[model samples]
Every structure is written in C-alpha cells, then in structure tokens.
Target chain A: MPAIIELRDVTKTYKLGDETLNAVDGISLSIQTGDFVAITGASGSGKTTLANIIGGLDRPTGGSVMVDGNDLSKLRDRKLSDYRNQHIGFVFQSFNLQGTQTALENVTLPLVFARVKSKARKQRATECLQAVGLGDRLKHKPSQLSGGQRQRVAIARALAVKPNIIIADEPTGNLDSQHGDEIIKLLRDLNKQGITLIIITHDMNIARQAGRIVQVRDGKVRA
Target chain B: MRLVDYISLALRNITRRKLRSALTIFAIVIGATSVTIMLTIVFSAKGFINDQFEQNGTFQQVQVSPQTDINWGNGSGQNCNSSDCVKLTQALINKLAKLPHVIGIARQTQPYNFDGLFYGSKKLKLNQVVAYDANGIIDNHMLAGRDITQSDGNGVLTITSDYADGLGFKNNYQALIGKTVKLHTQGYYSGVGSDPVGRQQYMQTHCQNMGPGQNCELPSVQITGKVVGIADANGLTNSSGYTVRVPLSWARGMEENQDYGPARTSGDYCRNMPGPCMPPNVLTVTDELALNGYSSLIVKVDNATNAAAVAQNIRGTFKIGAADAETAIKQQLSVFNIVGIILGGLGGIALIVAAVGVINTMVMSILERTREIGVMRAVGARRSAISRLFTFEASLLGMAGGILGVLIGYGLTLIGNPILNHQLKGNNIGSSNILSLPIWLVITVIAGTTVIGMLAGLYPARKAAKLDPVEALHYE
Candidate 1:
C-alpha cells in the first residue's frame, strides 16, 4: 500500500522571551492508507504538534510535508483550509462543540465550510450523528448533553465531511474510563472501515490498542 | 462559504446580544431621521417655488426696464432723466417685438391717481392700481369670475381677494363679481371720469373770495367700475396683495393730464361781441402715456430655454435692462442649497458618532466570539468569510435604522401636509401636498447609511480575520 502521508525532516519552533524551543524537530514519518496509528508521549513532549503539522493545521518551519501527493508546506491559507475541509478532521480533548448549537448543527459545521447544499448537508449531518450513536439527541445542545454524549457529538462532527484521515488529540482526556473506552471503540470502528486514524495521547493503555505506536520525547521519536 | 450562510450566521450573532444591538441601532436612527427631514424640506421647498413659477409661466418671460440695473420681479426701473435712462417707448416696444425669439409683449403701467376702493359702506385702501395689455404674457391666479380681457373696455376691472374680503366678502369672493365699485381719487385730481365743467364753475365762484396765494383744492373724483374677477391675494406672479387691475385703454385715459381754459379762437369772438359776452370754455389734454411711456415691458420668448438668450439680445440691442427668471431662480435656489448643506452636515455629525458606536460594538463582539471564530477556522472557514460576516452584520444595522427612519419621516409628512394645505388654501393657492419625499432621496439615504456602516466595520473585521487560530481556540 502507498503511504498516504509523508514527512522528511519536518521542524517547528517557538520563541518564548528570547528562548527558542523546538516543539517539533527533525521528524521523518510515514503512514500507509487505511492504517490506525497512535503517537504517545509525556505532557509537552511534542506529540500534539506533530499531529497538527500532519493534519495541515500548522505548517512546518523547515523541511517538507506531503499529504496525498500535495505539499502541505507550500500551500497558501486558502488551499490549506480547503485541504483541511476535504481531507482532515480534528477532534479536540475538550470536545470543542459549540455550546450554543444543537448536536445536528455542530455536526454540520465542516460541511457548511465545504459549501455543500443546505438540504444535503443537513441530511448528511443527521446520518453522521446516527453513526456515532447520537441519533436521538440531534436537537440537544452541548450543555444539555452528558460528557460522553458531548464527545460523541464531536466525533460525529469529525465524520461529517467524510474525511479520509481523522486526527484525535487526547480525544478521551475528559471522559471516565468506561466512556473513554467507548470512544476508543468508535474510533477503531471508523478505522476498520478504511479511514486512516492518528491518535495523540499520554495514555499507554490507549496507545497499546492501535495497530502501530510511535513514542515521542523531547521533540524526537524514540526507537 | 456561501453568501447566504454568512448572512444567516451574522444575523444569529446579532440576535445573541439583543440589548447591545438595539442600543447601537438607536444611535443610527437619530442620524437617519434628521438627515431624512432636512433633505426633504430643502428639496421640497425648492420644488414648491419652482412649481409656482412654472404655473405662472414666469420662466418664459423676460422683464425689460428703463434703468441699466434690474432684478427679477421688480420690473419697473427707478425714475431717471432721459439722458441716462432708456424709456420703454412705443418705438422701442415695436422694435423689441420684432426681435428674434420674441413671441409676445405686454405693456405694464401703474396709475397712482386712485387712493381707495369702495363697495357699499366698506372702503378699503388700495395698494396699487396696475394696467397691462391683456395678452397671455402675464397671468393672474383668479379665485372667482374672469381675468381682464382684450375686449374689456372702461368700467371693467379686477380686484385682489384681500380687497374683496375687506368688502365683507371674506369666504364668498364670487359675490363681489359684477358688483360696481367706486375708485375715489385724491384731491385736485383731474384724471378720467372727472367733471371738468363742475371744476370750472367751482373755481370761478370759490376763488374770488379766497386771499391771494391761498390754497383752493378741487373735490376728489370718483370713478366707477364693475368687478370682473377676484384674484388670489397670495402675492404670486408679482401682483400686490391689495391690487386692482384695469384694462390698458382705461389706464391710458386715467393717466392723461387734462387742461381746461378759454379756447384761443373764442378770444377774438368774445372781444368782437357786445358787453357781457362769455368766453368759450375748451379742454386740451396732454398724452402722458406718450410722454413718459409705459412703466415696463414684459417680453415672452418662444421657449423657457430661450428666455436668457433673448434677454441678452434685448439688453445688447436696446441697451435696456432685461432679466430672465432663470438667473434669479438659480441665485435663490443656491441659498436653499447652502441651507441644505448645513442641515445635512449636522445630520452627518450624528451619523459619524453612530459609526463610532458601531465600531465599538463590533470590536466587543469580536472579542466575545473569539473562541467561536477559532472553531470556525478549524472547521475550514476562510479568513475572508469571517470578515464578511461581521461586515454584513454592521450594514444590516444601518439598513434597519435607515428604513425605520424613513418610515417615521413619511409619517411626519402625512401629519404635516394637511396643516400646510389649510394655510395655503387660506391664501387661495390652488396646489397642495407641497411637502414630499422623492424616491431618489429615499434610496440615497438608505444606501448612504449602509455604506457608512460597512466602512466603519472594516477595521474591526480585519482585526477579527487576522486572529491566530491556534491561540484563539484556547481563548477563554
């Protein structure tokens, strides 16, 4: 199988009061199509930064990143935003569902940016919510929903545009162990259906469940 | 993203903070309503004045005077000697009549012999007694009966409504028509309709008893005429409030200077006659109309557009003062234009302050929605989309305020017009609804406010668009 994403010596740096920190440094990685990969590290060990660069949310400061044969480092903001809309879905640890919007509306956000027809966007959003076992709570707002249900709504939003790759950064950080296990099972189910997945976390138990695991420490990959 | 989506989202955001949005819109309402009222008044006043002149056909007529300098509406020149003033004589009128573009002419004169007009027991002081050729060049707004015509001979005249009202016919001016009115002249008057034989007998009987150089005044003369029309007393078309209009033929007779004495041929006959023979009485009249000429001449051009050129031609050819209404109208309208600007500037100040309020509100809105903006960006909203959403919101505020203001202004006009109409009706003006809001003014005000709001939103929208997505996502 061909590699869907490739990175050769990618680096990202930040300056804090004249002190330079390498958030991501000298990383070369590849993920095949239809693969579930996990990246695990300690807090502030650059795992999330690596995931962000791969998802086209942030550009590498140096070197190159290629996703599906397009150079992510060379793309402008308009094209990068289009790439994210069409190809990548991000799930945050805090769920990041708009508190004021209904579950269906929250799930329809990405498809709206994709410029889908309103009727079709609504229909697809309902289907996405149902796939994450949230069909009954389509009209419920985030404040009305439990923690597990809120995370399910976020996952449903990530699946709205039928993205080819899903990047979840600490997706279960705020959930109990049982709810967290349920969310991991849902992600694995999506992965089993041929969507490439990348999970970023500090949990050894969640990392051990992926098909492949990469350990990150001090902006470097451990052997 | 689609434009509809941007609008929907913007509307939603505005509804999120209803109190703030309402306050911002209230500020804009003050500005828009003031602007609407000022513009409507200025433009409507200009339209009303222009309509009055247009109805009278004043724009198509040129006034010629003896003096070199003359303003419109003051047709006659001040008294000047023959060396310095060009008299509006018959020969000059004939020549001016033949000038190119000259369609018609009306010779105008004012006879000051009459002091009062009497109807029954009521006597009203006359402001002026005017006579002009009954041509179509000059028009009078008549409230009752008919204007003086070319066939109207002596004893036929028209009185303004004020004269009729003073004659106990206030609301019923038509009753004054066909009623004979007496024009009482000043003492020592010897104009038309005077009794020369009675004056001669009185002087012979009365003067013998008077001391040398003592004053011997003649009795006042009374001329009678049947009222032909009742003119509106609104001072329109250059007519005075208490004016009385008569035929030019009657005025010609009234303006004559009459002399009465013994005939020259009778002197030989009387000397050859026996004792106690009487000298024959004879009268000699001086034609004052020919000597002094008419007071002014009104020349009607072929078209209103040709009025100015014809006036220029008359001024150059005859060296007399000639003026068209266009020049005076422009000068008068420019005053209105300046007033409009000052009033509009005051309204503009209000709008500017409203724009500041819009800016402050938008900046605050962007701050409150920072996390939402970050989430939108992550969901693939372009930076341009965010900017457009806020701009749409601001312009919507302006549009709503402008619409509401115009509606309120329209309501005010509805309430104001009837009162104004009553006042005009009392003055005998025929037209009403002089206050109006033209379609262009309405469109201009709404579009202007919307553009102002869009400009005010630019800076804050840019600030929102330049927000860093990653940092904004974590913003509390």
Candidate 2:
C-alpha cells in the first residue's frame, strides 16, 4: 500500500526571543495507509510539533511534508485549510469539543464547514458518534458528558469528515486508566479498519500499542 | 458555506447569549426610533408652513412701493400721488394682464360705511366695505346673500344676515333689501367758526349761536339709501364692522369726496378747495389709501407646462426679482432637510455608542469561543470565513434593531398626532395630525442602519479572523 503521509527533512523552527529553536529538526519519516504510528518523547522532545506539521496545522520551516500526495509545506493558508479538511483530522489533549454544542452537533461541525447538506451532515455525524460508542450521548453537551465521553465526541468529530489520517496529541492525557485504555482501543480499531493513525505521547505503554514506534529527544527522531 | 447555514449559526450563537443580544437590539431600536420620529416632525412642520403660504397666496407675488417713509403700524409705508399710485394704474394692470402667462387681474379699495340701522337704541358694528370692480375674481361665494353690482354704487347698502339679525330685522336678505333705516354720520365738524363740541352742546348753545331757528350746521346731513342689494361681503367689513360690499364707482366717489372718514391728507382736502397745497402731479397716496396696498403681486401661469418659462419671463420683465413656486418649495424643504440632518446626526451618535457595545460583546464572545473558533479553522474555515461569520452576526443584530426602531418610530408618530390635534384645537388652528413619511426616507433609514451595523462589525470580525488556529485551540 502507498504511504499516505511522507515527511522529508521537515524542520519546524520556533523563535525564542533572539535565538531560534528547532522543534522538529530535519526529520524524515513515512507511514503507509492503515498503519498506526506512535511518536513518543519527554517534554520538549518535538513530538507534538511533528504531529502539528503532519496534520497540516503548522507549516514546516524547511523541507517537505506530503500527506495524501499533496505537499503541505508549500500549501498556502487556504490550501492548508483544504488539506486539513480533506486529508487530516486532529484530536487534542483536552478533548476540544465545543461545550455549547451537543455531541452530535460537535461531530457535525466539521461537515458543516465543509458545506454538507443539513440532513447528510446530521446523519453522518450521528453515525460517527455511534461508531465512537457515544450513541446514547448524541444529544448531551460536552459539559454534561464524562471526560471519556467528551474525548469520544472529539474523536467522532475528527472522524466525521472521513479524512484519511487522524493525528492525536496526547489524546488520553486527561482520562483515567480505564477510559484511556478504551480511547486507545478505539484508535486501534479505527486503524484496523484501514485508516492511518499518528499519536503523540510520553507514555511508553501507550506507544507500545502502535505498530511502529519512533522515539524523539531534543528534536531528533531515534530508531 | 451557504448563507442559510451561516445565518442559522449566527442566530444560534445570538440565542445562546440572549440577554446580550436583546440589549444590543434595544440600543439600535432606540436610535432608529428617534431618527424616524425626528424626521417625521420636520416633515410635518415643513408641510404646515407650506400650506399656510399657499393659503395666503402663491409665493411669486411681490408688492412694490415707491420709496417714501410713513409709519402705518402693520401697514405699507409707500407715499405717492393717488394717480401715481393708481399708476399701478389701469395701463399697468392691462399690460400685466396681457402678459403671455398672466392669468387674471383685479383691484380692491378700502372699506366704507354707508348708513346705520338703529333698532331701539342699540347699534351693531358692521364688518366690511370692500369694493372690487371684478368681483368675480375676488371670490364672491359668500355663506349668505348676493354680491353688489354697478348700480348699487348710488347709496345702496348690502347687509349680512348677522347684521340683519342684530338689527331686529327678519334674518332674510330679501326682507331687508328695501327696508328703511336711519343714517348717522360722525366726523370732525371743524369749520371757520364751528366749535369742537357743537354736537355735544347743540341744545344749550343752538339758540344763542344761530339767532333763533337757524341751526349751527344741519347736524351734518344724514342721508338714508335703500338697500338695493343684500350681497355677500366675502369677509370684508365696513368701518362699522358689518360685512359689506359696495360698487367700485361708489368707492371711488367716497375716496374723492372724503366721505369715507377723515381725509388721509389735509393737503389732499385743501388741494381740492381751489388752492392746491402741492403740485397736482405730486399726488400723495396716504398710508390709509395704501392700507389696501398689496404686499405682493401674484401672477398665475396659464399653462402648468409653461410655469417655469413664464416665471423666468416675469422675472426678466419685472427686472425687480422673482421666485418660482418650486424654488420656494425647495427653500422650504431645505429647512426640513437641515433639521432632519441634525436629528439624524444625533441618532448616529446613539448608533455609534450601540456599535461600540456590539463590538465589545462580539470581542468578548470571541474570547469565550476561542477553542470553537480553532475547531472551525481546523475543519476548513478560512480566516475570512470566521470573520464573515462574526460580521454576519453583528449585521443581523443591527437589522433586528433597525426593524424594531422603525416600528417604534411609527408608533410614536401614531400617538403624537392626537396630542398635537388637541393642542391645536385649543388655539383654533386648523391642522392635520397624520405623520407623513416619504418612501425614499424610509429606504434611506433602513439602508443607513444596515450600513452602520455592518461597519460596527468590521473591527471585531477582523480580530476574530486573524486568530491562529493552533494558538486558539490551546487557549483555556
């Protein structure tokens, strides 16, 4: 199968006052379709920065980031948005579900921005929430649901757009061990269904569940 | 995304903060209402003034007086010979009448009193003594009685129904036509040796002064004439305050003989008695004679199509000055416009304050929805789209406010009319209380409010649009 995401010497730099720091320095990596890859590192290990670059939320300072055959490094702001919408989805550490919207509405938000018709967007959002084991919580707001349920809603939102890749940054950071395990299993099942997944984490045990593990320290990837 | 989706989203967001939204909408409503009501008042005032001008006569009418100085107290100050004054003259009248667009010409003389009707010791005041040669042009549709004619110039008196009623006569025109009445003449009885109080001391000093049987002066011969016609007075009154109409010839005779009252000029009376005080050519039109002087001359155009051209021609012919009705109306309208602008400006200030409130609320909303914004950006919303959503929300608030304002304004106008009518009734001034709102003004207000609302959204919308998705998502 073809590599759905390719990173070639992708260097992301951050300005720290007068000096520049390399968050993702000259990292070359690839993940094939249906692969579950884990990028594990301590704090300041550039794992989250790499995830941001791969997800098309941030541009690389140098070199290329190609996902689904489009170079994200060269994409303009508008094209980057389009790329993210069609090819990559994000699940944040805080389970960034809009508290004001119901679980179904939160999931449907992506499709709404994509200009999907109301009925189709609602139907697809409902299906995605159900698939995430949130079938009974579709009408409940994020504040009304548990942390695990909110995380599930966020995952459902990311999957609702039917993107090829899911990029999660510490997806289970705030959940209890049991809920965290459930979220990990959800990602593993999605990967088993042929969707590529990339997760950034500091937990060695969580990283061990992935098919491939890449360790990073001081902005460099180690085998 | 589609407009419907955007609107729905905006509406939902507004609904989420219902109190904030309602407050913003309320501000807009007050602003719009004040603007509409102020404009309506200005419009009504302008209409009322124009109506008054029209009722008086056309604005084109101008009265010219040769330079002289006299204080008639609310009267003309022109002094010229009667002939020179009359030189506004048949020739001038005919020339003006024959002008291409001139419609009609008529002349008027001051009021005169003929005879007194004494009904058992009470004397009622008469109304008018108007004399017009072309009575048809003078508007003779009286509430009662017929108009005087050329024959009535010979001592005939036309009494109004009120006058007849006052005199104990049957309040019918025909019944009072040939009825006899006593005549009384009052004037300064000054002669070569006549005393000032001869009339008052008549019984006491009559025998001593007249050497038995010869009266000092035959109590100024009181002449009685049959009421040949009971005519419509057209609101003109004789000196006694009775609504009266006499023939033009009779009026002229009264003018020449000093029969009306005191002679306006001692020189005029002296000039007629064989030794002229001044040159005959230097005839003086006294302030009293000029009391009936027209302040302006109204020249009506024959063809409405030719109104402008005729007005221009008259201006050129008179070489004095000219003002067309349209120009006059525009001048009147400009006052309203100025008043409207001032009021609109005041309303604009209010809207600005409301806009600031809108901006603050939107900014606060953006702060609250940081993560949501980031989520939208991640989902494919461009910065511009985010900005557009917020801006759209702001505009909707303004529109809601504007609509409510218009309603409130109309309601105010509805309530104001009765109050205005009641006040005017107390003063006996006739007026209509309906508020006049032109279609263009309504459209302007709506468009203006929308634009203001949109402008108010711009800054906040830009701030919302420029937010970085990654940073925003990290915001707590």
Candidate 3:
C-alpha cells in the first residue's frame, strides 16, 4: 500500500550562537497507512525532531515532508494549522491537558477549535473518552487525575479529532512502566482500528511493540 | 470563532481568576465614580449660576451702557456715548410699544454723580441710583412693598430692601413708608495745568461752595419724599445705597446742576418732560428694542415666538453682535464639554492602568499555559484563533468593568444629591440639584473603556500566538 507519511532527504538545523547543530539530517523514510511505527533514539539523537517534521509541527530546514500526499513544507502557518487540525493528532510526554478544563472538556478542545457545534462536540468527546476507558472520569480535572489517567485523557483528545495519524512524542515518558504498557496497548488498539500511529521513544521495549522501528544515531537515520 | 463562543470562553476565564478580575474591575469603578461625581458637581454649579442670573432678570434682560474708562485703557474702546446712546430714545420706546408683539417699554437712567446721605445718627452713601419713569414697565414680583406709581413720581422715591435695611428700619416694607431722606452732594474741582500741590490747593479752594454750613464744606439738600415701595434686594446690591422711581423731569434738571452732560442728553431730558427735544435716531417696529451702540439690549418679549424674528430684525438693523438664550446655552455647553473632556481624560489614565493589569494577568496565564497552547496548536488550532481567544477574554473583562462602574457611579449620584442639598440649607442655593447624565454619555464611556481594555491585550495576545509549537511543547 502507498505510504501515508513520507520524508525525502529532510534536514533540520538549529543555529546556536556561532555554531549550527543539525537536529535531523538527510532523513528519507515512509510509513504506510494503519502502520504503527516507532522512531527510537537516545537523548539528542534527533528522534523528536523527526517526529515533529512528520507531524507537520515543524518545517524541515531543507527537504520535502509529505503527509497523506499533501506537501507540509509548502504550507503556511495558517494552512499548517488547518492541516494539523484535519490530519494530525498529537500526544505529549507530560500528558499536556489544559489544567483549567475537565477531562471531557480537554477532549473537546480540538473539536471546539474546529468550530463544531457544542452539542456535537460534547457527544464526540464523550464517545472518545469512553473509548480510552476514561468514561467515569469525565468531570475530573487534570490535577485531580492520576498521571496515567491524564495520559488517557490526552489520548481521548487526540482521538476526538478523528485524525488519520496519531503522533506521540514520548507518550509514556512521565508514567510508570505498568501505566506506560497500558498506554502503549491502547495506542496499539487504535492502530488496529486503521489509524496510523507514530511514536518517538527512548525505551527499547516500547520500540518493540511497533510494527516498524526506525533507529536514529546523531542526526541521521541508522541503517 | 463566533462571538458567543468568544464570550463564553472569556467569561469562563474571568470566573477562574475571580480575585484578580474583581480588583481590575474595582479600579475601573473608582475611575468612573470620580468622573461621574466631578461631572455632577460641574453641572450643579452651572445650574446654580444660571438660576441666579435668571433671578436677576439677566436671562431675558440685557444691560446697555458706555464702556468705562478702564476698558478704554485696556484697548477695548467700545463705548456708548452721547452720539451712540441716542439710538434708544423715547421715540423708539413709543414705536416699540405700538408693535403687536411688543410687551412693555421702560427707560432707565443711571446716576452720574453719587451724593452721600446724612440723617439722624446714620450716614448712607448712594452708588447707583437708577431713575425709571413711573409709567415704564417694572417687575412687580421684585417689589417688596408697593411699586412706584404715576402719582408718586412727583417727589416720592422707592428704595431697595437693602437700602432700607441700611437705614436702620426693622421692617423695610412697613417702616420705610412715608419716611423722609436727605441728600448730601460732594464736588471736587482742580484747575487745569496745575502742579500736584497746586491741584490740591485748587481742590481745597473749590471745597468752600457750602452755604451757611460747618467748616467741612458739606452741601446738604434735604429733599424729603414718602417711600411708596420697598423693592427686593438682589444680593449684588451694595450696602452703599439706591433710590428708584423719581420723575425723569426732576432728574433732567438735576443733571444740569450736577454737570452730568451724558445723562442729560441720553434720556433724562425727554423722559422728564412730556415734549420732544430732538428727532429720533433709530426706529424699530417691534416692542423689543435693542440699543445698537451699547454692549447689550434688555428686551422683554410678550410672545416668545416673536423673539427670534425680532432678534433677527435687530441684528440686521444694528449690524452688531447679538445673542439669545439658545446661543448663550450653547456657549455654556461648550465650556462644560471642555471641562468634561479634561475630567474624562484624567479618568482615562486610571482605566489605562487597569488595562495594564489585564495584560499582566493574561501574560501570566499564557506563560502558565505554554504546554496547553502547544497541545492546542498540535491539534490544529490556528494562531489567529488563539490570539482572538485571548483578545476576547480581555474585551470581556473591560465590558464587565465598564458596566459595574456605571452602576456604581449612578448609585453614588442618587445617594449624594440629597446630602448636598441638606448642606446648602438657608443659603440662596436653588431647591433642586441638577446632576444629569445623558444616555449617549454613558454609552460612550462604556465603549471607550472596552476599547482601551482590548488595546492593552493586543501585544500579549500576539506574543502568545507567535509562540512556536515545538518550543512550547519542549517547555518544562
């Protein structure tokens, strides 16, 4: 099958005073739709930078980044926001739920940004929360929820947008091993449901669960 | 995003930070309250001044007199002398009286020389003794006792209550009737081309004009007349003294003796005699006759509808400056407007300070929610949308503060007027207090405050919007 995310000689550079650091250099890769891929690397190995480029969160310094046949490199800031809203859902290491909002409202944030009707947003958010096994914790705030539960709520928010891809950057970095395994299993179940999944991680066990694993050394993908 | 959604979001944010929001709103309230109170005081003072003017018959009445010597030295040479004062003569008064819309015609003559009065144990001085014809129009409402009539013009005189009070009368109206008063005239003469000391010697030489009197040369002429009426005391009336309603005939002959040439030629001659001395200078077909050469004309219009037409006709005829009540009101309102703007501007500084508080609070919120913004941006929220959300929050804060300020301001005025009135008891202050706030003023204040609030949020909102998703996500 054709790939849903493709990177062609993607290069990302960071200027630090008088020196330049290449975060991701000459990375060429593709992942098919419904594929569960993990980009694994140690600290400062460009794994998160590669994930950002694939998720359309950051533009590569030099090279083409195509997601679902759409060129992300050519999209402006506004169009990129629209593209992300429609095609990408993000999960973060810290389970970045809006602390002021309840779990249900956090899930509804993406739909609210989409200008969805209030009633429909509520209905969709509720269904997504239920899918993540957080149906009973809808009214709980992020501070009230456990670290693992907050990650679940974040997952539900990502799914509520119904995007084609879920891009998680160290999705279990803040949780214990048991909670991390549960989060990985939930992501795997979502991938089985035909949604493409991409994870950036440092843990070898987490990388083993992915259908395909790409290893990065320095700024380049390892052979 | 829709306005309703923005409002909801903003309201939610405000409710989340209740204490900070309340403090910001309280600042606006204080600013608005000061503006309101100051405006009320300005309005009340203007109303009070206008009321006093109206009581003095100045609202509809104008004073026409020659520019004084002081004005001439000030480079303002506008004066009504013998040549110009002739425009408002007896002929004009008679002509105006014949007009269909003409209400009343009264001629006034100002005293040229003031003569001091010496009676039993008390000495009274006269500054302005206006002699009006007994047949002329008089405001009966101002009469404390009986007004001067045609029969009393022979020798009787009407004094103001202030003058009567000065004469040691317990009841001005009752005690002053049939009482006789004396007049003492003082004359000073200095020969031309004399030195200062020589002028002083000449003055002393002219001081001996007294006949069979004490060595001090006090010329006393006891002209006794019954006090037919006592008039109301306008507060401006000096305790110096005043006598009204003597016959113009006696006053004209008296002007010759006093060498008051201007008073003799102005109206004292024709008003005293029942005959014509010279041809009329200016002719008017309306009862309301204004003097062209004088500073102003005091006209009493029987029909207010004819006022505009008469004023227009006079302006065309005289070719000088003319103003009515409406013009005067507009002038007063312009002054009030300037004062209001200055006060509003000072109050605006306080609102600006409150707006800075809003920006600070919003910036803190943005900093605290950096990761959340990253999450939102990752999920496809646009930068413009995020900026609009923040701006909406600020606008809501301003609008809320504006509403609360208005309520507090209006409430303060409602409660403060009575207390002010109580403090003014026994004074000449008017019975009613005027603190009027038009609806347009309220709307402008609220809208202005909201705009100021929104402006304060703009830079912070832009900063929050420009934050990079990657950088925000990486933030600890």
For every candidate, what is the interface RMSD in angstroms?
0.9, 1.1, 1.2
Measured against the true two-chain complex, the DockQ scores of the candidates, in the order shown, are 0.52, 0.55, 0.52
Better of 1 and 3 by TM-score: 1
As for DockQ, the candidate ahead, 1 or 2, is: 2
Worst 10 residues of 1 chain B by lDDT: B72-81
Model 2 interface RMSD over true interface Cα atoms? 1.1
Per-residue lDDT of model 3, residues B1-476, tens digit only: 55677788778888988898888777766666666655665676577546544553434432222322111012112223446333544544565456455465445554344566544667777644455445534453344557666554445667766567778874646866777765544432111111234333444576556566655532334444567677765532111124444555444433432211133344755776666565333311211113332222345556555655654554455443333343455556677778877877777677777878878888987897787778778888789988988887777777777777777777877787677666643342324455656576578667866776788779878988999999998788
Model 3 misplaced regions, further than 4 Å: B36-297, B300-342, B419-433
Mind giving the per-residue lDDT tens digits that candidate 3 earns over A94-163? 8878888999999988887788888999999999999999999999999999899999999999998799
Give the per-residue lDDT digits (tens) of candidate 1, residues B198-309: 8878888887699888998878899999998998876457555668999999988888867677776776877778888778788977778777888788899989999999
Model 3, residue A174: distance off in Å is 1.6
Residue pairs clashing in model 1 are none
Q: In model 1, where do residues sit more than 4 Å from their true spots?
A: B64-104, B108-131, B139-147, B154-297, B301-322, B415-430
Error of 3 at A83 (Å): 1.6
What DockQ does candidate 3 have relative to the true complex?
0.52
- In angstroms, the error of model 2 at A29 is 0.6
